[model samples]
Target: MREIRQIPSGSSLPDTQWQPPYYDAAPPPDPSQEDTWDVVRKIWRRKWLVMGITFGFIVAGAGTAMVMTPRYSAEVRVLIGLPDPNVANIEAVLRTILPNSETTQSEAYVISSREVARKVAYRLALDKSPEFNPALQPKEGWWHAVSPSRLLKELVALIAPKRNDSAAVPTADSAPMTEEQRLEEHIEAALLNRIEVTPLNRSHVLGISAESQEPVTAARIANTFADVYIEQQLMRKQRATDRANAWLQTRIGELQQTAHESDRAVEQYRRENGLYETKSDTVIAQQMGTLNADLVAAENAKADAQVRLAQATPRLNNPGDVDSLPSVLQSPLIATLRGQQAELERQAAELSSTYTSKHPKVRDIRAQIKDNTSKIKEEIERIVRGLRHEAKMADDRYTRITARMEQLKRQMGQSNDMTVKLRELEREAQANRTMLQTLMQRSKETVDQREIQTSNAEIISYATVPRNPSFPPVTLILVMATLVGAGTGILLALLLENLDRTFRTAEEVEEYTGLPSLALVPIVRGRSKAPGHVVKKPYSTFTGSLRMLNARLSLANENSAAPGGVMMFTSALPGEGKTRISSSFAQLMATEGQRVILLDLDWKRPNLHRMFNQPPGAGLADLLNGDITPEQAVYHDPASGAHVMFAGNVGRFPGYVAWIERLRMLLYTLSRHYDLIVLDTSPALLAPEVLHLARLVDRTVLVVKWASTPRRAVSSEIRNLYSVGGRIAGVVLSQVNPRRYRKYGYDDAGYLNPRHLVHTAG
Candidate 1:
């Protein structure tokens, strides 16, 4: 037994508030910024689960590929040829087409249409084939009852409301289709599903692909589509040509009738009017033309005569003036008279100048001049008379011509009405004859076209038998399954990791609780109750862990007022190895020549006495009540050289609230004697008394069973201790599984089971 010695008054610990070193604890790294190796390690920790899932997916993929049916595909390429436009500018709607993108797509649609599908189905007798027609196959077996599709359909039926849509819909003759028709339709639908029509590169060429169990049948089906489509096109063109010819023949007869009627009417009209097809104009028109020309000439003559008379009449009062008229002056007799009169005048002027006015020569010349003037007048008058006579003749001729023209106009008016009617009838007959000739020519062409019409679609390439199946791509499925499996496994591992909220490493404890993790104690499997691992293997990994814990506590107390401080071991919940850890620490301290007392203040569940292999005894309570001295009351452990104080008659242990001061006094008295005192208290959460006890101790070490204690409970207990002003030194990750701990990639437990070559003499 350790001897009790006097303790100085200053040996009592100073009242110091616990301040968690916030800066020492690093903030958790962002998950995105976490190291890649960290993620790898986390996944490696759950490798078994991941590998199992991956293997399951691989097997499923291989199984699915093996079970799937293989289908062979064959392609038939057909080029759609546009029909030649009609010479008559009348094109067949289906035959003449442009090869535009829309046209190509439309051709593809035609190749895949229900009509084409039906034709292909009938040609192949698909309705009688077991593959295309379900009705032709044997009845489904009992396995069909438990099929996923069947069960899902049954579930949907149960959940869905019953609808009466037949009453709201109309039916032809209120009758259902016959079974054969229904079967054919079903086969056609199935054929359509198996057939794929694609307008390759948006061109006029169409690729018709068909899938079947038999490679030969696939090729046959594809080829049959092209044949049926072309044949259908030919049949349509022939029908169209026949209809066109019939219509043309009927129109020709109608045109003949119209032409005959028109010709007869024109002839009858011509006979009634006594008309002939001599000229466009009539005899009255010719007569009128002659009269017009004569009338114009006569008018011109009469106008000239009147103009001459006008000029002569104005000057008739003076013969000399009349002689100045253009007509009179033009006459040869008037010209002669003017010349003689001028000569006579010249002779008279010469006589007058030579002799007296009464002279014989003057008298003679004057008389001659007078005689010539008289003759000129008479001539001028004659010319005037001629002009007047001519005017009269022109007037009479104009009047006769005008009278004749008036008669001709009357005749022309009467003939014009009959001519107009004749021309209209003749035009109608000519139009009917022209149209009949065109129709007769077109009818001949239409009748001939039916024999030589070409198909709009031409098969550019024939389909050949395929050599391989296209469905159930095994390699691709296996690869995808592997990828999906790995992804799912990693996802589930991460999900479970996130869900588990436990302290896994010292860093995790420090980061979560804002307290320094003092140590990592490897789990001593099956020896947790007593920590006997510290005895036989004194320098093993387990003892080394306890040494680390002891060193940290010693270092913490080095700066504290009391070097020999009281440390209480406690945890959030029971069964966290707190008692074991406290006992082990006390025994370790004693072995190192330190006077340590292991006190079992957990009256509710005392375990220190059992760890020392001792029975019931008076412990701290008896010592405090002055019932026994330290030597008599405390039992010394021989194995570890530590003093033990078990809870004596725990039923007599007083109320925690009233006994807190007593417990504090007892700890101080033990502190004076022992170099260290370890109080093994009950779980902080299980016993509220632990919180009161925590404040009396110099430092409180929280014992957390690694990966077993929940983080929230640790945080709650820490808060409780903090509220009571307990000095929490740090945390201990107790009972750590070394393998899993290393998997976390934390090297804090590197000293445990290290892989190294120790060169020591055997």
Candidate 2:
């Protein structure tokens, strides 16, 4: 069985103080709360660059809008009527059958329809318009006085009504065949393309809109369409009435002749029979009354047939057919064929109004009519045969009656003694005939009333000339464009921000390394000759920040076990200003009246020789290897009054533990002479130089390059230093941007812009 040991808390037992082999790595920074504000801060941090890019897009969009041809639009309103209840059994008829939905659909279709659209095109006379004319030019404006092409682009941008540039395209003078006429032509076609027709949903109103180079013209086109459509409707109704009246008149004439003849035949039959014109002779008089009723009915049927034939014939021939036709004449196949033919005719009419004769539809209609004529003739012949057979049957019945009457007349003459009986028979027939005549007159009046009611369709409301224009809603269009532009701009900003990968702030350094930032050193130019020493002057921002950092570090551990301990300087990689920081810190300490020693522990690449203006010679390596003494290898930095040592003549791959042990011994020997030791070690992660040196150091300072050092490299370096017994003091973020640091929630008031600094220094 395994046993567990209970160790006292906070006690440094042999095993507890052994230190884990692995470095306690700081967990990764969470980038989850990155909100819109973060993106905005980033934009502000890179304001100039972002502004330049966004402006580029705006300019590009504006330029594109400029090159495009200017256009305008107009509109009109049309109201469609529902069926009138007063006409033709309206409720019942509607319940049984209804007009095609297209009756209303055409209102919307009219916007794209060749008929209405072409009329607008013709009215504007766009067919002869010139595409490009140098004579028509833009005039000088405020934008014109700016960079080249500004004026034209600005003019094009003035699509809003308040900013319209009417003078952009010049009008041609009538004297020289003014461009106005040509312009109108162009405007005409443009208006057709810009035209829109929309039927109000679930309503009878139609909105027609059109666009052109001129706003007023766009309005005019819309109004004209309304006027034309109304005029067309009125004309169609009048034509329909004329056709109805014509057929009614022809039918009335035929009925009048038939009625007159029937009256004469009745009069002759009464005279021949010698029947008294009284209501008593029921039998023979009733027979005459029956014949009159039959004649009236036949006349009425003929009249109705004539009216129907007239209505259907004219309608079928009228290529501008109504959307809704009478149900009696409706046939799906016929309607489809006619609709196709009507469309072809309509298209033809646009090119030439006289196209009715030579159009393909006209040819097809002629063929259809020829075929229908044969069928109609055959149907008429069959109906005529049936009528003839009925006429023959009536004739045969009359013959038989006449023969029986003749025999009765002869018998009556022979039996003159039965005169009372013949007289009584005559009286009865007369009485029945009088009642029949009264009934026939009433029937005739009723039929005439029905026919007149059926023939007429009342004009409910006359089409009025429209007072307001219907198109080119500039406010709506401009608003939509602006909103679209704004949304697109925001999306573009986010996409660009996500694509950016540059390190931009001091907080990022602290967050990456889990260390407090000591200082943000600006990248200085033309300072190649400056000594690798922290400027002791309190006036410099960099030096002041360093002093602040030192004070904060010391105060943080005032009651710690060790005070004024070793501080090591290292970085993730080379060229991150680590050596400069180390030298500067040592100089800063020495200037503060504290003895400081700056050691170059980067055995692979020693830089202290250059800083001290000394040659690379026998130093720490030779001294530690027993070739020389520590006192012989140490040198003084004359500029900052600090002691320095170059790690010299050392192999690139020295044993880490052996070197650290010897280095610790040398440090312990020098601790009595120097109050502080600043070791400038090579990049910890890149090489084991810093890790080996970390064991002898009391605290470590990692140098990071702002907007250059990757977070992964810094974190890895910090972990490596810690694993080797290096106590992380803090980080020194180099090459920081004041604006970016402030944006990342830091007070960058003490920092100066690098460019401004260089300018001031120069």
Best by lDDT: 1
Runs of candidate 1 exceeding 4 Å displacement: 1-51, 81-95, 145-174, 262-288, 297-397, 404-434, 473-487, 526-531, 535-540, 558-563, 603-639, 646-652, 657-662, 742-753, 756-762
Positional deviation of residue 500's Cα in model 2 after best superposition, in angstroms? 6.3
**Residue pairs clashing, model 1:** 523-736
Against the reference, the lDDT scores of all candidates come to 0.77, 0.57
> What is the Å distance of residue 602 in model 1 from its true position?
3.8
- The CA root-mean-square deviation of candidate 2, after full C-alpha superposition on the true structure, stands at 35.1
Which lDDT tens digits does candidate 2 get at residues 1-762? 111122221222113233423434454444477876776765565565555655665565565455444555445666665442343332221111123457567645644454555565566554543322224445646744663345444664485233123432445762443566655435444444466777657656677766555556556667766666655555554455455555555555655565565555555654655544456644444555565566555555555555544444554444334223343225454555555656655655564555566777667656665665455444443443444455555556555555655665565454443335445544545544554454344344433333433211122233333344332234544455555655566656666655544345656555545567666765544553377435534445566556666766665454442225567888887888787777777888777777888888876577877766778897878877778777788887766788887877786434667766777777776676676778888887767656666656666778888777766677777667655555677777775555556655455544454344444445
Question: In candidate 2, where is summed lDDT lowest over 10 consecutive residues?
Answer: 1-10
lDDT of 1: 0.77
Tell me how many clashing residue pairs each candidate has: 1, 28
| TM-score of each predicted structure versus truth | 0.75, 0.56
Report model 2's TM-score to 2 decimal places. Answer: 0.56
